[model samples]
Target: MSIRRRLGTTLVASASAAVSLLSAGQALADDFSYNPPGTLVSGSGSGRFDETIYAPGMRFPIEEAPAFLNSQVWGHGGGSGPGGSQCDVENFSYPWWDNYCETRSWDMPLCPSGQGHQGQDIRAKSCEKNVHWVVAAEAGSVTNIGSYSVYITAADGTRYDYLHMGSVQVSVGQDVEKGQHIGKVSNEFGGTPTTVHMHFNLRQNVAGVGNVYVPPYLSLVTSYQALIGPPVEPAVGSLDEVSCDAIRGWTQSPSSPEAPIDVRLYFDGGPDTAIGHPFLADLSREDLCTAIGSCEHAFQVPPPLSLYDGVDHVVHATASDGSSNAPEVANSPMTMNCAFELPSGVRRRVADLDSANAWHFSPFWDEIAVSDGILSTIDEGEDLDRTPRLVATSSAPETLYLVDGGWRRAVSDEIVGVAWQFHPMGAEIISDEELAALPAGKPLRARPIVLRSASGDLWLVDDAPGPGSTGPGGLGGSGDDGDGATPDGDGDDVSGSCDCVVGRAPASSAWTTVFAAFVAAGVARRRLARGRRGTRP
Candidate 1:
């Protein structure tokens, strides 16, 4: 199989859950950015690497590469040579430039970084400097711009570092977008420059340990495709929300004006369609709207269960630098719908804590998951559709589903945290805070649940049946319509009346067939007797 396919097919451990978000925001929010338990190699780094930790919400570091990279030439999995070492020279059949987390670099006594490769190594199509622009993987403040290295720390404390940078564009303490150009690719170690290759690494904070290295091969490989055309964010909810009052608003990308970040919207994850007429005076988000310029586009919600068929859908948004080629997911926030569906028969009881609001529900589905954030019933597979699943209910053994599972919120804005999980019962809402407290790499306990909504309504999602019906009794019992509206109430009577009674069959009608059978037999016997008497005379 091709290298990228191999990497993509090898599903990361469930521990590597969540690659994107389906929130009201427009940007893509993924669960785990770099695929983890990343092929561990002993020779890439010249030092002791910490535990294999997954960093969620990361972006690919390289901004511009071929739309489709030569997967066969270079990718994860080391090259072969003596002792399966020498990643570059070992595979004569394969190009030397392609290697990630390779064990071949183990004995590079010259490279004292570590024993194993801690990051992904990327080389431009040909040996060229100041051509391939390496950008920030995700928007974050720059820091620790070293001699041959640079680090961009995301708001969530996830860190991205690039090595072998020739000319740096961003300074420490500066903010950047997902694909903002930061520098050119070249060997930059001050004294001795190695190959003209950019070695990329990621550092995510573990529970007790801090900033451990994870492989960026898959993340890089995936991001490499953004150059192919408008790339759909693999996971959803990576977008930022553009709020307006009339259940509608016009949004633009980059929040800039200079070379206003031009973009195209792939509504419902369809082909890219040019959105909006031109850049209007976008005063939407005065704070983070691009400084250069932006375009204002209007989006309206299709009717429920009608827009994209009532199931949650997405708008795979890709922002560009107005150039036909320089497009990526940097400034634009893809949007998702956060749909809230309530079950019938459950009493809208108030929770113990809040009073005014009853807990209605809003499940989060991840593009249009990017567009809206609400969730719907699980798909045909019953698998958790949304990455960083909103509610992974244990419907079957070892299977977590989004259906009958989601947040208990009356409104969308009430939901919080970088990620979330819920106990099957409504008793507790597992926040990221609680997750940090728990032991890492351990399974959360499963329980039948009753969730409370943001409006204080109790969501009885337990497997057991809900409280019995309180409607008008069926003819025989007390004919009270539980909510105090009797049969003779002064309301427009919408209830239909029945002509036949629900109980007791009529006795005569029931025995009609049997009575007919007896009479026919008697008549036959009498006719026979009369015929015999006449013949004898």
Candidate 2:
């Protein structure tokens, strides 16, 4: 006889026995009960009892038997016996067991060793011809798809395994919609009555058994919900500049070579509500670099200068709280400036300039004090003689000619004032020929190059040539001028007298008188020369 016929006969026999037991007043009050409920029964012997004999309302949980069968299928406890005795249950019964037996040693004879069946089996009736199609319970990415079995893992980490399938319809990594057909039920195991049925099981942690087994029904429900859930949206927010003080005590050392210079949105903005908490968002160094317009996050300012000199940066913060009511916070633009060096070796002032000090460095003229006899304002103003000076504007390769003689160049440790370097009118540029034609070594006094005004012009003054012609000696005119008196090489007595008086006799001596007389004479000559130069027009 076919397997289906055998299953049909078994069901009929069980039903008849159940009806007879009720008539005889031997029926139990439980939903489903066994003859001697807790005792084990043998598969081949007369230990078999009809399932329907216990209760009128109780019926097999599954409508049909599993299409696949295995002899090694046994209860949680190890057991073995004839005609797949493992199918029989004992005193302690779970909702899943179809039959019970007394001998713990009764194991399913059909299943192969080392491949023990993990799920339960149902009895199939011969008249039930259609094998139920296995379907996915939840929505998720199909992690593993196979011809005989298919497995899916939900985003929440739950896993579902479907075994004994004929043809898997989906491929690995495919996103499966809920309730999709995986495959049709196939063959059974061992030499049991060749019944057409399906065995279902739920396993957790495919990695190991420390994972608990959930009921097949429960798993199906959960998988169904996972596949149908709505998609998640990304959160948004603002990033703000952080004070150095906030990170002064940070313990985790940054792996990057650049020190931590910027406060990220993750660090500056509070927590993201979408993710459910505040996190140092996993941002790549490239992202931060693009945001800051710098090569590295941790930048080093020149010694003593704590201020940052760079473009203003804006950080974007996202809300973490799931509430739609929360608004995104954005940080105001933070401007960095060059830092100042302190007297002590400790570099302190390297920080963002306060709002009050964010003025742009004009390419025009401004008066600045000289420190240690060195001119400090080179780009902003011309030399004292009103000549145009060439100021190095930017590090980029573009050449900026001195318009109206005002150009500034940042020289080593000082802003060297340029003069007499005017951009010729109607000429878009000043060529190398023109630059060379101008004074080579002489300082060119220049009028501050102004689009509109010319207040900060610089003038190139003629100073005597020689070792003593530059710096303190050249400027103070203390060196000898070939003649015995103070050096008056430029014929200017005002600067020469001061130099002459130093290292000389007191005010009352003959040398003092001689020096005064000579200085007065030199002053008259200088005034005449200057007047001539001024009136040359």
Candidate 3:
């Protein structure tokens, strides 16, 4: 047997060898119930009850269901004390158990006693070994392989360890996708066999602490729910209205009708598609109060500027109750046809003179102003598009500016890189004179687009990059159809891990380098508007 597995079984089994696993209480599969975190079998020691889902959108490791997630050593199996066959019917049943912090001697800071089992042990559908397959829980590259262990490390540095498996199909340094098969479950612990099961571990760096193992039961439960449909119906609500001004809605859980629920609004697609955000349904509504005995069940937020582009933008509102199943509000998927047109013949371009680039926008360009205050005779420049791409200046490469409605608004690197892709070296060098002449408007702020990760958590992602590409002379330069923006509304600033500072330019369009999948960090709100257009320096 593996050194850790043998140590774990000895510690946990000897402590509770006389206690039947059934004594923990019977949990039905339908209820998806389980003992609360830290509620281990008697003598197994306490477990970590931390509820944070460190891994969102992870895939269930088992390739198929009928597999049971219960204690291997403490169950009615042939190990320390109980002499029942490991294939007993009770061994392959639900609800799942939390053995992450079961009794052990390993160094585990997250555990209550500072040392315990580092992961959860799961039994396959039956007692047969080397038949049930185990797959990758998240997309990552295989970093290590042992005689009976495999480790995959994600791009973000989170490591996933799978042990006690046979027929290994992956080698060290091989990239694997979530749900991809790695090997079959077996009792292969070096040269000795322990029990027919798979042991899984999650390791990542935590602030104020070094790399360590975290609780994985909650993440496994979420992913398992995704694998099998939710047992209960999702919360219900209504998308009361979707107007040119604001989108309003109300949501309530049948399980708890009087409590206000959270809702998410998606544009042009379901929860998995397009841009969306979450709004609290805690606003008061007399109609809802009369119907459900709760007044604080309404949600209302102004329509995003992206949806007012003279087209049908479908907005769907669904309850966000941290469940796999997401039920849309009644009258959902309503269309928001708020048309905001851009002025025709507006000249928008990055005027380049030497290494300096100036982003200039005007309703009508009567003439061109080049170096030395010379009004040079130039042909008609290109017109600005509806949604202008974000840009930066050579002088201030760290800051990205959004030009819209005849105004230039400073955008943070968070929005420029992670939320929406922009050229790192996309800043155009403009003369100081031209830069001072451009007017600054309100910061280009908009509501964050909420995205659901593998762990079933809703994260606020910023908007996607706009319609145009950057060129040799900066944005809208030669060989690319550069665009500009118009219109505005209120939204929270985004936060992310990618810095996206100006550096080497990629050999693609301006908005080609997408820096996606970052958690939203709320930036301090800036003043409503900055310097006005044409305001003399």
Candidate 4:
């Protein structure tokens, strides 16, 4: 069957969005946040949509109370920053743009010059989809529900657009109030899912100009501040082991990356030490992933960083607890960081589809290849039983996803989209003509392969082209940089300071909402928060 046919009904069929909008008297003061507690601004999606496709939208003057109150909608994640390749139009065709872009570029034809990323991308507390709520930022009427997005029109005629939802709760003409549950967070992007993030945008109908992008960062920050009060200490419970190439650690707290924005190591109490960002390390480590929902983290340094050059270096960690002035978690190195026995290359397989825990792939059934960063025909006689061997290492083409061919990927016996879903060895994507051209026994290519976001996971895609904004642990903003994310907020807030809205929200109740599980990553649907929660990867 076609990929869409296989996945259409798989996800989001049961998300609680089926509940209709409240009949009347919708409250106006939605002082509370719509996103669950601990949500972050991971990708910080650009509003480049207006910059590239539509006319310029109105910009909110951050300091103005009216704008702040009007733009009080919140995003889903905890991290934010200037990520490399946030607007990766290179892999795809022309005109289409991602949600966020700070350093604007419009040189490409059919694209405007000054328009940058307009909206910000928020992440649910975890990468797992569906668990997070896509609540209405303000009381508004649902105007449009396209395959890829949900457009809610606010009282002022401004539009708050939410993208990539697993399931849309509100329908056209339904009225919604701020913090009203509208949909669930998801990887749904029409057909092409772009990572697990909620792409939020604020559009204004400028009389002569159509709906345009109004910078929503300040309002988002204010909303985030209102939702999550003062920053608390990062929950860095313990250090596992340290090595030259990677620093392994865990947190007793709720760690997906477990608290702390950036984990820094001060070598020898000296001025310059190595800063190793974290990622999902060794998925086979069941104990950690089970107890902490995959809290295992590692900072793998690239070759050029001389910091790991052998001499004994004392190391301690300084972590930011997603707050402005929280005390840093000072943890001394439990063990020296080393690169010994590390894979040095990223290798994802049908097995990484190890969700649901029903069936698992044997190590031999899986394999790693030096992709040479381009698409290639699978080895002629390969099967699940054979170890994966690199057939294309010298080519410099970009890394590509194989056609969706796995029956096992659909845990619920439903197909999500085809992108990134693993197919068996023989069914490479090829044209019908190319299929005829192939040797009698060779497999034929059938569909388009998608690109995996480039995080700093050196194991599988270290050599893959396009070091994208999706950083290690899939949290956007490769923390390996000096300062992870600049506010890119409105007015003075754009500077290093995370300007708090003073008393917009009460400090006593720190995190307001409590989230449970995520939506299906591929199919774009999620179980109801009331249903059996899926284990987040």
Candidate 5:
């Protein structure tokens, strides 16, 4: 046999042994049966009872069925009518009396038209004198009480309907204990004459839609077995935890590849035990770094991946025993990649500006790089100062342009910094003509910007770099002069109309020479600054 199959067999054997040991001395009870109106039967009745009688933690509704005939006549397990006719065998349907027997031609079964009775009919002697008291099978509130029906809602949200009731004694909203009398059974309506019986029915609402009938007998049997039996144990198996680390990479795309983190668990138990129970793994890139020195591990998960960033997810596994459990759970940290560059020469990234909002943004970003003053302020412009103005942007239509921040035109700048308040996009360098057409408070062609706060509140900032200044230039540049020409070199002015320079070095030697020159210049400037400070002192 295969190893997995052998392991499964062993687990099953072990669990079965445990259950047998636990229930060794206890005897399972037989299902309850009503004595027909007339019959005589005898048996040794020595077989393991498979029928269930009660649910766990639930009580029987009534101590006993109410007396319908004289006490002696009721207790004999059967009854006889006038002239020595067998009453129990007379009116009782086939299958109840004799499995092979067929209904008499003159008699009508409960399901005469073949509609098939949805509920079982427990026959009563008479509708008037018997006074069949209806009781609740479990402790529940009387959710609905009417003359013809009484509905009891159990703690587990199951509703029991005792329909065709003569008159309800319980009122709506009444708290009823288990076995409390709610009403009396009567077949005064909804069935043919001489077929008086309590129509017990069970209906379950599927997904908040309509109700479907489930046999009451089946529910009763299952519930009864659960109550009397030992608690079912859950199965156990292998548990796995997976995670990913996203670090800065060579790619210009928003996503960057980092390290893989994984942990595996081996278990020896039942497989089904893990259902509904969450398996948790708390992992952080920092933790992995501390443990392994490098946050890299073998990939237990297959490629063409789905999850990104920090690695926390719930996992389900089947055990050797035909059972299953969720053995692995992972939680990833909130991360954001600011590698997205827009047409306006701006870059955008998300950050969990507030620690309190960590839960809100954790699902989207892979890594959150922390720095001082990543958040910016709101610039509502001078115009909307008196009015409560809010800025909002749609990620669609354009990658980072502002949609509305009380501005007429779209923001033509890339987002530079983001915070809970205002996020500063790139600076808007407008000409004197564009600035002059502003209506005092409102600037013409205002750069539209939207800012979202930790509280989910949105604001609009127009014509202002709300907080942080421009981002650092390309590697060769220092401050604003990086875009200037490189004298005595083949470096041409690649700066676009926006005054931003894009430089390209020769495939072989240009980058090396340029880098060395910048380094030398930086060292000389540092010495000069230190000398100036010392002279001042």
Candidate 6:
């Protein structure tokens, strides 16, 4: 028999849906960040929307640590110095900018404008030129060389260009491995030095667009993350239960999955203050086998006697395998209000709503109020498992619902596929009548906002903005001199920083009405505060 499929709806169904959903006043801390595609420096043209990572697994162009991916023309020590030396610490910091279409007169079909700058500019380890080594992003051969450019052509007809180098390492037609030394980053603009940075470009045969310069900023960011590894402590686990009897949780590092990591508990204070000795998370958990691809990563420890006082206390957990600043597991910083007088039976029920007990509900789930008095009078009638569980009807097996806390929330494809990383195979099959008995809760929503301003700032505004907050601005430079002309020497149609005429155009207002709707929803108060900055060229 054919069964009807029921799926969870996404919060980000459309731009309008996103605005309405985000306007609901549900706030969360920023966990991920990225500049939206086409959000370029003001006066620079609209960026291309091609999200192709042409050179997947490609090495970061720079061959050292702490490389800054800012614009050369608008960055410090360039045409528009942000009032500091090139070696300023802020210049080396992150939230990198995209300069591919940053104002130039080149035939770039992919850019919103038919003509624009053709490549991305990357700053080396420091302000100095010809010191940091530039490596081959992909395994390819040096096809051609110019006074200030070296081109590597992969077997797939994908061209990788490296510009403005001091010591040219590889010769033309020479085979080189990925990450092989190609040259040193410099400011050799065919004799006249422009800026001490590397101009990198990616050219490939796009199906519809033909041979054109694709966006490399996203690709570079991906490869760079692979090179440097995840931020500080990238632990992937969660704190499951906390009670007067004992505290329970699990943790594992993606970097080292096979080995068990240590989980430390802190009370009242943050990670700096540990209440008791660290507990080794080596116990096996059946659910973890599918959730995290590992089993022996569970931990259960008794609450310290000192926490038995009537006052409520907050507890946090951090995983450690040697790295400093180990990240806190999910559902952490849970609150404990257990007193010695509370019966052991009631303690378990209080722990079942552990997250609700501390207002630490997952961003996917809405907050529910559960008071101490409510927990003390709990009568153990039916033996129901309060832990999160997946349920589906045999009549409509495809439709999955997350049964938790006497309520059922439909699980969407995105929720199961990405947000919570839940495996649908673990869902418990039940009769349709049984599934209808549970009370319905609000639809689950994954937190993360992708907001585009009237100005060309496409922000991934994750966290809640303060009263006077502002979106992360562009290069915030006053100059319009973006890699003015193509330096002489390269036979190909490549471009870089040079002494040439530059022009500026007014900022595009086509998106103003669309952006206004978001502001009206009060989801983008930060964008409304700041006036439009630069015009597109």
lDDT of the candidates, in the order given: 0.35, 0.29, 0.57, 0.34, 0.30, 0.55
lDDT of 4 by residue, 266-329 (tens): 4454212232332212212345546556533322211112232234556555442332221224
Ranking by lDDT: 3, 6, 1, 4, 5, 2
Off by over 4 Å in 4: 1-100, 103-113, 206-210, 230-537
275 Cα displacement, candidate 1 (Å): 26
Top candidate by TM-score: 3
Off by over 4 Å in 1: 1-60, 67-100, 104-115, 206-210, 229-420, 424-537
217-296, model 3: which lDDT tens digit per residue?
88787777767654565688898778654577788877677766679788777654343365557666667778877776
What count of clashes does model 5 give?
32
lDDT tens digits, residue span 41-93, model 5:
22211111122221222333322322121111121222322322112222222
Ranking by TM-score: 3, 6, 1, 5, 4, 2
For lDDT, the strongest prediction is: 3
lDDT of 6 by residue, 1-537 (tens): 100110012111333323322332121112123465566666555777666565554678898755667677666556654644444554555557777787777688777788777888887655456668999887777999999999998655779999998899999989887789999988889887476689999998886678888888877877676566556446667887765445678889787897777787778866433332465677666777798897778776545544544567788887755443356888987887644321112112223344332322232122122233333243332223334477766555545566655655554332222223343454687775576566553222231111112332222211111111121111112111111111111112112321111222112221122223222322211111111122223
- Per-candidate TM-scores read 0.35, 0.25, 0.44, 0.27, 0.28, 0.39
Where is the poorest 10-residue window by lDDT in model 1? Answer: 410-419
Q: How well does candidate 6 match the true structure in TM-score terms?
A: 0.39
After superposing candidate 3 on the true structure, give the runs of residues whose Cα lies further than 4 Å from its correct spot: 1-31, 230-537
Worst lDDT run of 10 residues, candidate 6, spans 1-10
How many steric overlaps are in each model, in order? 102, 95, 18, 58, 32, 2
For model 3, the run of ten residues with the poorest summed lDDT = 512-521
**Per-residue lDDT value at 307 in model 5:** 28
